[model samples]
Target: MADAEGDRITLSALQDTQAIQGQTVILPTALGVAPVETTGDPRIEAGWFDNGLKRARKELGQADRSVGDERLPVLIVTRYLVDGTLHEDRAIYDLGFALDGQLLGGTRVRIRGLSLITRVPAASGQAKLDARWKQLHPKLAS
Candidate 1:
């Protein structure tokens, strides 16, 4: 996604630091679920992207509940992986804690930073989609 200046945050820059962890990141619920909604539409072939977001949301929700507070920061990790053959795909991760209060209406969270945790090359677009699906839905991977 692009920042206020309309510049897309480079995936490389996002993974540069561990700052995003343990910090609260606020996201509109709309943007949070956009990937999932677009993927579910039969007319769109972005199911992989949608599935990944769903998985990430589930994992993050579990982690959030475990923390016992809703006010915690949310971590979001977005990436586009390109293999040696130049094939590319994108994925997003949710790694923050749960918040205690409402996140809407001018509320803002402080982002500590970002870090790269995984980098895998997929043999095809489908494979890349599967990788993201696996990330968001670990149960399916089993």
Candidate 2:
């Protein structure tokens, strides 16, 4: 959906994502009685927006002006919850700007890549999720 406040145009999308299936593997231990398992969680759902579009535009413009180019790097991190599942998503966006440092609203924002980790119900998924998230937080934040 699109909203206009004065001169700035705001765009938003909810229910715009699709769920990705997860996998779990079980391996036999050396003793042949115990099991070792590993899991890869799925992304259930996510919603993203930094509260306002005007603010984002200003920041992008400032970054472009500082670098004297429109090829500015943007990192988008989003967190959301649905039906007890927690979703964390990160994406790298390549924004296009004009020669005057104005945001090119009509230009397509290229998504270079994305990483998504989700927490879902399982025998021992929450703990593993927490530990993995903790380990990845520092790197992702930078």
Task: Give me the candidate number with maximum TM-score.
Answer: 2
Q: Model 1 reaches what TM-score against the true structure?
A: 0.25
Q: Write the per-residue lDDT of candidate 2 for residues 34-78, one digit (tens) a residue.
A: 221212332111111221222344433322123332322223234
Candidate 2 ranges with C-alpha deviation above 4 Å: 1-11, 14-69, 101-142
**Model 1 lDDT tens row, 1-142:** 2133211222232333322112112222322433222111111122223333334545544331223312211223222223322223222233322222235532122222233334433333234433544444344221
Candidate 1: Cα lDDT at 3: 34
Sum up the clashes in candidate 2.
0
Error (Å) of candidate 1 at residue 126 is: 7.9
Clashing pairs in 2: none
Model 1 gets an lDDT of 0.29
Instruction: Give the least accurate 10-residue stretch of model 1, judged by summed lDDT.
Output: 36-45
